[model samples]
Target: MNTLAFDTCFGACSVAVTWATPEGPRGAFRFERLERGHAERLMPLIADAMSEAPFDFSALQRLVVTTGPGTFTGQRVGIAAARALSLATGAPVASLPSLAVMAHTAAHQLKGETAGKTLAAAVDARRGEIYVQFFSGPDLAALDEPLLTTPEDAARRLAGRDVVAVGSGSQLLADGARAKGLSISVRLATLEPDVRFVPEAAIPTDFGVPRPLYLRPPDAKPQDGASLARVS
Candidate 1:
């Protein structure tokens, strides 16, 4: 199957066009790291990724996207693009969690003895907190609900565990754990979710239609006084 997958749920905007063949899975992708401008870059990145292997949008059978515990603007930009592309191409959009994507990426990158270790994925949520989750293994079967928490608090909860932490919050979480005399390892300085794995992540699960997965309420609130009157 030819699939178009993309993620704009964090500091990076990434897109990939992948095919599942008898030989194995193969694909190409574009990844750009930036704190802003995801809206401008995501679509073009997707097009570029597809064109790399001469895959057309019409050839896409599925659209996989990261539904996020990420930046508000980034999350909205990704889901909207996925939904619109699905409608235009008649491809089913599969929504996967960004945190899980990170976990899997970390797991795949782990070497030797670390390969089977427990994983902790965390994204910097800003304001001194992170979007954190624990997984039994790389498949990211959740050991707990994704939580918005301080690094210290997260470390406390996951203390005494041998965990390979990934994502932007990895360093902070690792440091916190070490300070608390717990065992934790940092896999990378940052491991933003990869769109290349979005398809794999979706295929094995009941991936529903793409939707924004903001773990907490948005910082922006509605203006009740400016609201239109209710029709009913």
Candidate 2:
């Protein structure tokens, strides 16, 4: 399949494009951690990735983007780009979770260490909370949907089992797990969604037009006149 995938679900923006050839699969991608400016960076990154392989957008057979339990801005940025590209090229868009991409990347990169332990994808959701999801057993089947909660709650959700966790929130989860006498190993402590595995991660999830996977309501709320006057 001639597929293109990208992620802007957390602290970074990344894009990947790949196509099948008689020789083998060929692809290219761009990844950077800017923590913000995902809207400005996403399109250019996609263009740069596709240009490396020199393929036309019209040739894309599939499109993928990470819909997230991430920053409100970041999730929208990636989805908007995927929607525009899909509209232009008629390629179907597959929405995958950013944490799943992180987990999938970790599974491939740290196969040895992750062998028997449960895999936990933990993104720092800020405000003393984290976005977490668990995967267990050989197939790495997801044990639950992505969740937004405190690190302590997430650690407790692991049921005191040995776990290998990845992402920026891993340390927090690790600390909480230790407090409860459970074993947790942290890997990729500053990780964002690994764009290389964005497409691979979709294989385990349902596909559809991308939508923001806000695990909780946005922090910013409309201020009423009295509140606005107080701030002023």
Candidate 3:
């Protein structure tokens, strides 16, 4: 199976491509951090990864991408790229939430440390809020839907369970837990999503087109009472 996956939901842009040769699965990847220029950096990064894999876009059998709860513009940057590529190459696209991707990363990086502990993945949604999801058990299955809420509320939502929190929102969750007498251990708190680990099932063969997962209304709104009258 030849697969392509990418993520641009938070502080980074990354691409991953894997193909099967007669020998085994071979892959290529690129990961970069650019909080403000993902739209410009993404495509070139992808092209370079494809070149390194010595494969063409037409070789892709499946595509994977992150849907958001992330920056409004950043979230769109990825979905737009994946959608355009799917249109051009005829490969199906599958989507996973950014927080779920973080959980996958935590599963890999924190390995043994995560034993018997829940995985708490969070994104700093600013305004004193966090985008979070919880995963539990050995396979790290998600325990519930992703959500947007205050750090304190997120802390309360953990229900006093021990969790290994990962992502930019770690400190806020940690602080909230402290204030509420709940506690969580934070790891890879500064990490961004890596396309290399976007959860294998996230790119299933029977896939639908990916879409943005913005949890809240955009911060940019049409100016109040500032629109000119439309003429017929």
Candidate 4:
């Protein structure tokens, strides 16, 4: 079986193609950090990754994508790409949350370094907010629910705790966490949604409705005088 996994929920866009082998599985990955223009770059990156792997889409048994509470545009692009690829190839599709992916990366990295320490995965939500989640040890037990809140607020909420803060939000919230006396080991650039930590599952044959994990509503709303149409 062959599988393709991708994540664009963060600053970097990544894709991997894996093929089951008698020895286990072999895969190839491509990643690029795009400050902007994720939509323009993702497809070409996917094409390059696929080309390097030399695998045909029709031969793929599964397609996996990271659904997110990251950038709204990035999340939409990733999920839409996965769904479209699955439909075109008749492959099963599976979705994993962006926070979970970050946690996975952290857990994998902290295997022997922090014997009993807890880890926190966070992403910049912009507008003075962060998308955050907590985990314990390598197993990555969930310590709290995923949320979007101000850096100061999150620091206060998780104060007086020793945590290995991982992800971009760590940098964004570093000052607040320090001021709050939180025992935080800032490891911002270390954690990323890479292939090694991605969880695997049997892709569902049914492609149900794909949903975005938006912590809050969009910033823009239609004007009162703007035309609105209901397809249904």
Best by TM-score: 3
Off by over 4 Å in 4: 109-111, 156-160, 199-207, 229-232
What's the lDDT for all of these models? 0.79, 0.83, 0.85, 0.76
Tell me the deviation in Å of residue 83 in model 2.
1.1
The deviation in Å at residue 185 for candidate 1 is 1.9
Instruction: Name the candidate, 1 or 3, with the larger TM-score value.
Output: 3
Q: Record all residue pairs in model 2 with backbone atoms less than 3 Å apart, i.e. clashing.
A: none
TM-score preference between candidates 3 and 4, better one:
3
From the highest TM-score down, the ranking of the candidates is: 3, 2, 1, 4
TM-scores, each model vs. reference: 0.88, 0.90, 0.92, 0.86
Candidate 3 residues lying further than 4 Å off, grouped into runs, are 202-206, 226-232
Estimate the lDDT of model 3.
0.85
In candidate 2, stretches whose alpha carbon ends up further than 4 angstroms from where it belongs are: 198-206, 225-232
Candidate with more favorable, higher TM-score: 1 or 2? 2
How many clashing pairs in candidate 4? 0
| lDDT rank order | 3, 2, 1, 4
lDDT by residue (tens digit), candidate 1, 1-232? 7888788888898888888768898888788888899999988888788877656788788888888888889999999998899889998887777887777666666644445666888877878898998988535577887789999999998865778888889888888788888878787667887766543643544545777877789778769788787899
Mind giving the per-residue lDDT tens digits that candidate 2 earns over 1-232? 8888888888888788988889987889788999789998888888888887757988898888888888889888888888898899998988887888888778878867887789999988778998999987766788899999998889998875779989889999999888877778898887777768643434534457889998989778777764554554
For residue 97, model 4's alpha carbon misses the true position, in angstroms, by 1.1
